[model samples]
Structure formats: C-alpha cells, structure tokens
Target: MPVDHYTYRVTWSPEDNEHVGLCAEFPSLSWLARSPDAALKGIRSLVAQTVADLRENNEPVPEPLAEKRYSGEFRVRIPPEQHRALAMQAAEQGVSLNRLVSMKLAA
Candidate 1:
C-alpha cells in the first residue's frame, strides 16, 4: 500500500522555519520542507523507505493507526482527590461514575 494511505499531518514549525510532516504510524520519523506539499511528499518517501527497510530486515512494520481497531474503551489515571470528587458528583446525579465521566467527555 502507498504511504499516503497512512495518517499524515503537516504543520508549520516556527522554530525550524519550515513545514513539518509526520506520519502517525511512524512517530519517530519526520520530514521538513519549505512547503506543505513538499513536506508531505518527503515524509511519504521516508515512510516508504522505512517500510522497505523493515521488510528487508524481516522486522515487523507497525500497522497504521487509522487501520487499527478500537474497542471504545480506554483507561485514564486521575488523582485520588479528583477521583473522590467525581464519585461524589456521580452519586449526587444518581449515576455511575463511568456514566458521569462519559457524559462529561461527550459534552
């Protein structure tokens, strides 16, 4: 598959004074160019070469984040005090802590 099929982002970097392109599946890699289009092209080429190198070495290539499946659940860590406050709020609203958090996140 073409590297462009993967998740890509191009953003301006004031420090570098250039556009930076990054691929979500290859977080360690980046390409900088004068223009957004050039940056994207450069990053895509880099990703393609990286994929080829991995394959040549018989190493596993990471699946694109866009192609991965999510179970609609993830864990988050909160401070004990915040956790207690949220639990009390959930109780006041007659809902489970999970439901209360879900509602807040959706909002």
Candidate 2:
C-alpha cells in the first residue's frame, strides 16, 4: 500500500517545545510527543488510522512521495539578466545551460 511507503520525519519544534512527527503525503496532519521515537510512532499510527478512514469513506488517498516516479525535468523562470549571466557562465564552463543550472542547483 502507498501508505506504507509514505514519507515520514521527526523534528524538534521550538515553538511547541516537543518533538514533532510529520508525513509529507499528509501535510495537514502531525503528531507531537516528548521523544522522537514516540512522535514517530504516533504519526505512523495516525497515518494508518487516517488511511483506514479515507478508504472507508471511498476517498482518494494521496500518492506516497517515495512511490511516485519523477521525470527529473521541470521548468523555472528567472530574470532575463540572470538568465543571460547563466548562459555566459555556461559558455565559459564549456557546458550546456541545462548542465550549468543543474550543477548549481545540486550544490
């Protein structure tokens, strides 16, 4: 099931002063606990219950981020001047503009 592969994370929340568990697939839902382990468990259980409820209601569940395939292609718009500069840099580096941008984004 996609729910089993859903992206999960636990991080500290200074505002709440407790650990927070999060699911990328369901951004609106979260679990809080004193410890990271408990937080993670809580979130996982919450996700399971939520998934069950969604299924019971015949609602479409979100696709798991880990289970989704990415084409590694996307479009972005930048200022003309910045675009020209990147082109010049690409020329100087002897690489395609796409390669130059990809390298910069990776860094």
Candidate 3:
C-alpha cells in the first residue's frame, strides 16, 4: 500500500528540538528529523518496510485509519440534568433533541 494512503502527521517537539512524524495506524512507531518533510519521509519508509515485514511473516497488517468508514451517527452519554435542559430547549424551539444537538454540532 502507498504510504500516502495512511494517516500521517508531523509535529514539532520542543524537547527533541526536531519535528516528529507519527502514523496513526502504527502508534508505536515514530521518526524524528530536523525538518518536517524529512520526518514524514522517514515514517513513510518505515511504514512501508513494516507492512512488508508483516506480509513476509504471515502476520496481519492493520488497515490504514484513513480508509476506514465512519457512520454519521454516534452516541454520547450526558447527565440527566443536562439532558433535561437540552430537551427543554429543543421543545421551546419546536425541534427534537436530536435535531437540536445535530445543529449545534454542525455549527
């Protein structure tokens, strides 16, 4: 798989005095370099090598998080008092609680 297909991020680390590259699908792996681009390149090479190693060992490689599907819906638990307040507010607006929450999230 192409390294671009994976979720990668580069961030500066004050402690290390360099940029660090991280791959979401391979949390345990990291690459540090003086520049962000180099860090990213290093991590990408590492990921490709790791995937190849896994394949050779007959081990399962994790799918890239960027390729995963997400449902638009998810559940969140809230205190009863907070729930009641939201419900009352939704009622005053002539909308369901779910609709109100969805609108707030979109904002």
Candidate 4:
C-alpha cells in the first residue's frame, strides 16, 4: 500500500535558551527544538505519528490529493480562577499553557 503524504509549511520561531518552536498550519501539531532543522524534522515525525494513529484507529484518512488543506476554529471557555490555576501549573511544569490544556483534554 502506498502511503499518501501531505505537505505542511512549518515555521520555526525562536524561543528562550536559543531553542526554536515549530508551528504548523494545524494548531494541534507543533514541536520545539534546539535548531530550525531539528524543528522541521520534528514536524515530520509528528505528522507521521498522527497518520499512523488515524490508520491504527481505523479513522478515515483525508485524501490529500483532494483536500490539501484543513482548517477550523472553536472557542473554549473556563472559569477565570480555573484558567489562572491552569496557567500557573503549566508554568511550573515548564510547558506552554496550550500544551497543558491539550494534555488535560486528551486525558
């Protein structure tokens, strides 16, 4: 079987300590690395894992030949106190607020 591939333009933005952050058009998928090339390589790894997961779970894989891009937006609301707590916890854990939220939601 041939594995279909989708191309994504990943941007590397500098973070603290000379590390760079990888950002894709898809918000759920990003990574941080010590170098720009490493960040882009990390993006490929992440995308590959996502594809594998979709296949393993028998989820419908979007036909990249047709749907070259996918985008969506939604709003999430939380109590102000709870939001502040999460932010503090994320900072303590040395991760982004978005990452902390993602892990919590995934669980």
RMSD (CA, angstroms), candidate 4: 13.1
TM-score of 2: 0.94
Tell how far residue 86 is off in model 2, in angstroms. 0.8
CA lDDT, every model vs. true structure:
0.94, 0.95, 0.94, 0.67
* Tens digit per residue, CA lDDT, model 3, 32-100: 999999999999999999999999999999988778798878999999999999999999999999999
Q: In what order do the candidates fall by TM-score, top score first?
A: 2, 1, 3, 4
Q: What TM-score against the true fold does each predicted structure earn?
A: 0.88, 0.94, 0.82, 0.44
RMSD of each: 1.6, 1.1, 1.9, 13.1
The better candidate by lDDT, 1 or 4, is: 1
Model 4 vs. true fold: TM:
0.44
What local lDDT score does residue 71 receive in model 4, on the 0 to 100 scale?
A: 56
Segments in model 4 whose C-alpha atoms lie over 4 Å from true places: 1-4, 14-25, 65-107
Instruction: Give, for candidate 4, the lowest lDDT window spanning 10 residues.
Output: 17-26
Best model per lDDT: 2
* Model with the higher lDDT, candidate 2 or 3: 2
What lDDT score goes with residue 83 in model 4? 93
lDDT of 4: 0.67
* TM-score between model 1 and native: 0.88
Runs off by more than 4 Å, candidate 3: none
lDDT of 4 by residue, 10-101 (tens): 45454554444333433577667777677677776776777778899998755544445445334699999999999999999999998898
- Residue-level lDDT of model 1, residues 1-102, one tens digit each, is 556679999999999999999999999999999999999999999999999999999999888777789999999999999999999999999999999999
